[model samples]
Target: MAYVPVKGGEAAILNALDLVAEERRGDPADPELTLAQIRTQQARAVDRVMAEGSLYDPDLAALALKQAQGDATEAAFLLRAYRTTLEQFARARPLETDRMAIRRRISACYKDLPGGQVLGPSVDYSHRMLDFDLAGEGAPTAPRAEAPVAAQMPRVPDLVGNEGFMEPSEPPAGDPAPGDLTRDPLAFPAPRDIRLQNLARADEGFLLGLAYSTQRGFGSNHPYAGEIRMGEVPVEVVPEELGFAIEIGEVTLTESQMITSVKGASGENPKFTRGYGLAFGHCERKAMSMALVDRALRADEFAEEPRYPAQDAEFVLYHSDNVESSGFVQHLKLPHYVDFQAELRMLREMRAARRATEQEAAE
Candidate 1:
């Protein structure tokens, strides 16, 4: 049988190829800055890599930019590329909140603590303004070799825990074998670890949008930042070869716990439950939003009706991935000629059968 090419197929393919080539060339006006230049000059880009990609290697991110010719988007892609190659040598001992080298810590409660909450690099309660001084050329040079900050710091005593306002958290259990979501398709009814791992790698924009939707009454979850902390957390790993746990390295983490007041149930006391969020690097907004969504998902425990889109675990978790969503949406544009032909034939047959039935009735 003879076949004809679909109209505009060749043009569509050519246009796609051209777009790919343009992206490869990057921004023509910038003259393709070197990776070293981006690393040294574009600190914000490096910060973005650490935040969105969940990898803390500034050097690696810089190198990736150099390789991709200073494309921030490509730099993020490279960081994610490196993330896939890493093997979980061992799960770290669950972080003791008391042990965190608190760079920035805040709690919304009685204003006093043993160690007062340090508000570091936070934009909280501040009016947004575009500082022209920051945008000016030839700013004062930042210090290159500052002395290292002291590691040991005083812990912020939990007011609620101390005053019997809140129940103390149970000590984390010893390392359990977490299911690998990368290796296995996420099974129905996932564990908290699996869900968290997925969210850590979720697209920032997607999570932000979903979180915003909840505020717009999609799932009206009243949330308050119980605590948001950013700091260096030691990562301990046990090597199979050594059979002993050792400190591999430390990673900067942002953790948020949103306190939500749930309605009292029959024979049960009303209490504040928490939604948890944590991510690599200093991503307060993402962490905060994640915590709110996490709490919202636990609707049954709260004894309140869940109305928000954020409360829907399947919808939030499944849609938070950019790569997955982008690929699936774009795949519809691929050659589905065979499927289309099958559908067309079925429609034609149905029309013919209907016409025949009408003719018989007339006769």
Candidate 2:
């Protein structure tokens, strides 16, 4: 993004910034909103910001949301900007979602699984109308369940794979470390790990739209939810001195495994292929959309022609990032006087020449 220096507008810029800050704070009569309130009350927004920002810090995400005046895309942009300043001490080991302390676990594919489908916390079955009572302070408190959710729940893919109905998700040869898009520029024909990472940090709305396109017959993959789980899993890291991993802390994650249509190569039995999605918090929509797009992007693997935007890995991966997309689109708001003038001059000259030619022909 190019930024042409203003000739002389320092005072105006400062005042503009100050006005924005004042507007963000709202009226002085109301109580100042705290970061904690945003974290607890608007947790879904924080989760979306964290997932899109590619950061898992709730407080920071909340702060970003507050600073951005609740604009989630802007909040995510602020989070990403802040993330660049922090120094990385270590890379944590991958989480085991199978051992996740189950919160809300459900499978669209199965009605009765190993551990009965647990709906920990959701508004899926709630009325769509807005509650005017909530407009006032001190709403009625929700009742709590006596028992805590189970420690571990069996995954749907594992159950289906055991029966040889689902395709095997074997680790890649040598189990090599996945490429980091943050560290390296994404190249064409990206591996599944990198593709998954791109989709994980992708914009929820964008992914959701693309996923919907597939369901509308833009693409041919009929997907089942298979499993959607949200929970906390322990984070572990190995220190050089210890040579062994130690539990650091746990971060809440939402995971989705989307089972797609069956496909088989010659001499192989047909089995259902799957797409994976993982997010920082209870973002079911984002996770589910990711799963659908992930499967669609794997057209080459399943020997399917790429006929849709979702199936085009290059198109999806490149545009999925909200920060980048927002930046590029918003950059047009910045100074473009010189460029616009140049175009204007060329247009005027072309019009003048055409008029002169018309006059000569008439004469």
Candidate 3:
């Protein structure tokens, strides 16, 4: 069980790293992929990197994607780590979805809403068929109708709020500052704001699994998708010297509004409770899953006891981080000779003891 170091491990590790770099360089003559192409062409991918990273620089996200070899979670971690190095200039004002330049907006609760259903870029209704022509010289496409402006489109939540059909999602009482999960460590019995911030940047796969668990009778609530919208929302920052808020930039965002039934309280009519999700880029699936988990974590607020893993805040939030989970899982690949030797010694001792007992019994 004594320690025995591997000879030439340092040299082998350095050589292995070099081999990995060389392997990443596929055909030498192939055209290099530019950052612009990754930002525009691999837009959805870049969006995912930005969302999960909690940083919105497209160029950095594109670079992270290239460095990570298109692994979304790895790319996000790269960007997330880089963000800690940057200086905090100013915090942006809370986003206003009402002013969003909507590209895609749909409501499941109503067929006819203020702006009608705008089914933007979605393949939900498309047939699953592979095209042979795409492999050959690509074919040209015909021109289509000009896209409508997003400013004119009305939100489904706004319309419902007018008639008081759904409860209003007012800002947290007293306009309190929101928690920054990246800067501060997560603790047990987290606030709703912190829970949401953590979920917003949590791994998409982890959130998806937890959300699916909620639907399959683990912590099931009769849920309905009130609305899901994808569009560009302007970012505003108020500089202390400037004395007023100004638009700094615009970023694409996907917002989900989920409604679920809760038991009526104290002679009041049963009202639809809300679960919300917002993320960078066209991330409908992540957004929806986030909304479901957000609602599930609010069991105590709704006067419902936690009955499942999905509903347990401590369990879900701690294990849902991709970076932490990935690092822990991948770390097993490292040498564990010391630990293995101890196990081997224990096994040998057990076998020798068993043989001595057998010989005594036979005699």
Candidate 4:
């Protein structure tokens, strides 16, 4: 009689999954907390959700966490899911960058602009140290104001516009509508809207990894941050009833312009071209990284030698999502007993045939 050892494999797998679930539930240090706690305590998590998903309701994100039972990651997923359902009431009158209510702004070329650059809240060049007092086991108190505004502020003007370095953009003839990426599947050689939508929801770790690869001589381009800005931009809509545009709300945004030096070719001037990046909320690092990657993707425009992996549009864009990558990788744990059994049978037959052949040769 022949015996197949594949029996009870399904049961074993089920038991293992159950064990893992039990362990997750039994952990004491991170006991199940409500979304309110996460919102109040884990503010960085809320920031990450808003930045990655292009949604800005910290409270709602917290509520989602509560519903998801204190899983911050799952809470972010829920927030993104909810965000997709909301209707876009109006496309903002294409933001006049000149009119931005800047909180923190900087430019690399000059020490100041027509309006001086303001260094708002930033950790740049600061020592990274943990303040343990902030983690006291009680409700945290708000810090006292150190100083008050005493002087009139100047506005930060556009560098390119002021210098007339680039041609001015032509104003659209009509009220241009934004491209809907969700309703339509992305086609090859995607437009800016589709690209931005994909990038907004991209996994931070994956983006960071690709960015690191570029820095390490893979599709590398020398890049400098021309400007980085974080602030509120006005959103406006012209209702049919109202003849003129009305300010509806304001959204926080981070914008980065990266300047890359490229050699002149084909009778072109040897000047720096720009790579643009923008994201919801104050995500300076992500914005800067995005600008760098965007420039790297435009290898042909720079007249640089194209490297295989970085220059492959499909490979770079397709694998940039954490949710998709994680799900596919983890799916391997699902039952494949039949396939394994078939492989085992094939291996045994091949071994037996080889032994028989060897014996026959000896005879």
Candidate 5:
């Protein structure tokens, strides 16, 4: 059977939009969410928006989240689209992660560290249960007693490097001008900077799936969580008139370091390698996934064969953007009457020809 093109009414389309709007604003009696509430209370969601959107304005991110009805990808899309209207004044000075005000810091590769592991606010060990109190007035809980935070913590990679365990003593501080994925069109065999930028904005769920694949032996590299840290980091930008850079503001960030054991390809001594991930907020899951994908996508750079989908840079980068991928998926709903009609006509002709051939054979 051939598919037939169905005609639609514009009135129905307009009514459907109104229904969607009404659905979004269910029960007017319920207290409406304020921008400040979303910004402060839902800080993690806002942070995810900022990180994926590649914009750090908390207030704007909050607004985008509210506008998106708490959909992170939609909020990110809103932020990313709005980011283009603003002028490109100047690029901020490179971040100094060493100076990050450590909040939640931990290591999986080691039992202890120089500064000690701080298990800051985490749901890792929490029981998954829905709180009915949240429907009304929620019960308050006292804050946990925290140990005095260290002024500075040594990076896990640095620790491993001190023990002469890593192939490259320290991760390369590649001082190259960062690529603007928004401005430049992505190309094959992308540079490391561009690849990282894409991963930074890539859909979290997509990245997570890819990362999980590697862990399940699809693209095994023997990864261990070297370190994961979340905290506020000061932003600094240099103006043309001012010779020195000045602090603009501070924003929350999550950084992940993934270490993997590898056999040297050229008969060199086997040593540990690293994959780095950094994002705009307290997003450990995203950061870890980004780190895993970061290493997986670097198969070519490491002279390793692409054994899985995660290792294929082109496959990962091209399909990673949420906005692009989501839009493409949604576009299928739009009317393609002319195109569908042509396809249906072709199918009908082919079917008719096949029937005629059968009748002639019977005769």
Candidate 6:
């Protein structure tokens, strides 16, 4: 339903908007969903909204999700639209993931690595069956405790790098401040920084499909999951007067690193390249997908052919944004009266001319 208010359409628009609010409220007999409950119970949805919205406020994300009626992309769009009005104050300093409080860490390549594995809060090894017992308000199971994981878990990439087969994470010069896509318009052949920002906020399903394409042998770069870790990391910012950085708060993050090999020209060693992904909460799928696509987009650096859609930078970057995609599609529902009338007039004239020509031929 078109809700845009015209000069004489105020009354109709108000009624339409009220109807929407009523629909959103659902049955009056049923209990209304509270923002607190949504944020706590539907935590994954909140995380996704925060990640795609590029905002870290869980409460706002939860409200957006509620407002959007559980539609994740719509909620994300709402969050992003609201973000435009906020003024920038300070950019947090880069987070130190190594210092993350150990919660979940796993590796696909090696069963044992430095600091060992801590499969914290995962369903990977669990059965995929529904438990009807969970349908009702049941007794909550108290969380079991084990010996705390090591304070500092060295990243899996570092362990593999000691063998001298792994490629450096940074460029030859070094990793400069990543380009901000929010501040600048997206350009073709974007830097890793810009590419990463886009992928992080991209629709999870899009990235997952692209990542799967590489695994299916659509692209030649064979990959192995180097590491996946999720935990809380502190956000720090340095004031202009004070040279020291202070912690503002902590945000949960899931980081993924995938290793793929780059063939050397002539008679040279094939060094292992890295695909890195990071998501705003404990979002493993998005991070893993982002890492895979990140590697595939680096086809230029590896001097590999971009035979598949996954490897094409322009293809991935342009279509990955759900916010932009949804906006373009939803805009078609708005009034297109003038354009439609012009098309209708042209079609009528063409039909009339065709009928006249047929009569002349018969005569």
TM-score of 6: 0.93
Worst ten-residue run, lDDT, model 1? 148-157
Q: Model 1, residue 118: what's the lDDT?
A: 72
Is 3 or 4 the stronger prediction by lDDT? 3
- List per-prediction Cα lDDT, in the order shown: 0.69, 0.92, 0.85, 0.66, 0.87, 0.89
Q: The CA-based lDDT of model 5 is what?
A: 0.87
Mind giving the per-residue lDDT tens digits that candidate 3 earns over 1-363?
422464547687789878867666666797777889899879889988998899988999999998787899889989989999999989999998778888888888899877788898887779889978778756667758757864767666666667766666777789789888888999877989999988888888899999999999988577788899998899999999999999999989999988877556677766677788899999999999999999899888778989998899999899888888888998787678889999999999999999999999999
Instruction: Give the alpha carbon lDDT tens digit for every residue of 272-328 in model 2.
Output: 999889999999999999999999988898899999999988899999999999999
User: Residues 1-363, candidate 1, lDDT per residue (tens digit)?
Assistant: 222454557798799778876886678986766666666677555665666555678788777666655665556667777889998655676665446677887877536644566777667768898778877667678766533434543322244445544434452377577766666777656666777766766777777777677677776466667777888888777777988888877877888877665555589655556678887677787787777777667676556576777776687778876557655887686668888999999999999999999999999
Q: Model 5 over residues 1-363: C-alpha lDDT tens digits?
A: 333433347677688878877776778998888899999889889988998898989999999988788889899999999999999888888888888889899999889798998889899978899877788766767877867788899999888877777756334476656777889999977988899999988888999999999999898698999999998888899988988999988878899999986656686766788887899888999999999998888787678889899998989999999988988998788778899999999999999999999999999
Provide TM-scores for the models.
Answer: 0.75, 0.97, 0.91, 0.76, 0.91, 0.93
lDDT winner: 2
Off by over 4 Å in 6: 1-8, 172-175, 361-363
Q: Where does model 5 exceed 4 Å of error? A: 1-13, 138-147, 169-175, 265-267
Candidate 3 lands at a TM-score of 0.91
| Clash pairs, model 5 backbone | none
Give the 10-residue window scoring lowest on summed lDDT in candidate 2. Answer: 1-10
Clashing pairs in 2: none
List, residue by residue over 254-326, the lDDT tens digit for candidate 6: 9999988755656767778899999899899999999999999988887788899998899999999999998
Model 4 compared with the native: what TM-score? 0.76
Cα lDDT, model 2, residue 110:
89
lDDT of 6 at 140: 79
Q: Tell me the lDDT of candidate 3.
A: 0.85
Q: lDDT at 263 for candidate 6?
A: 59
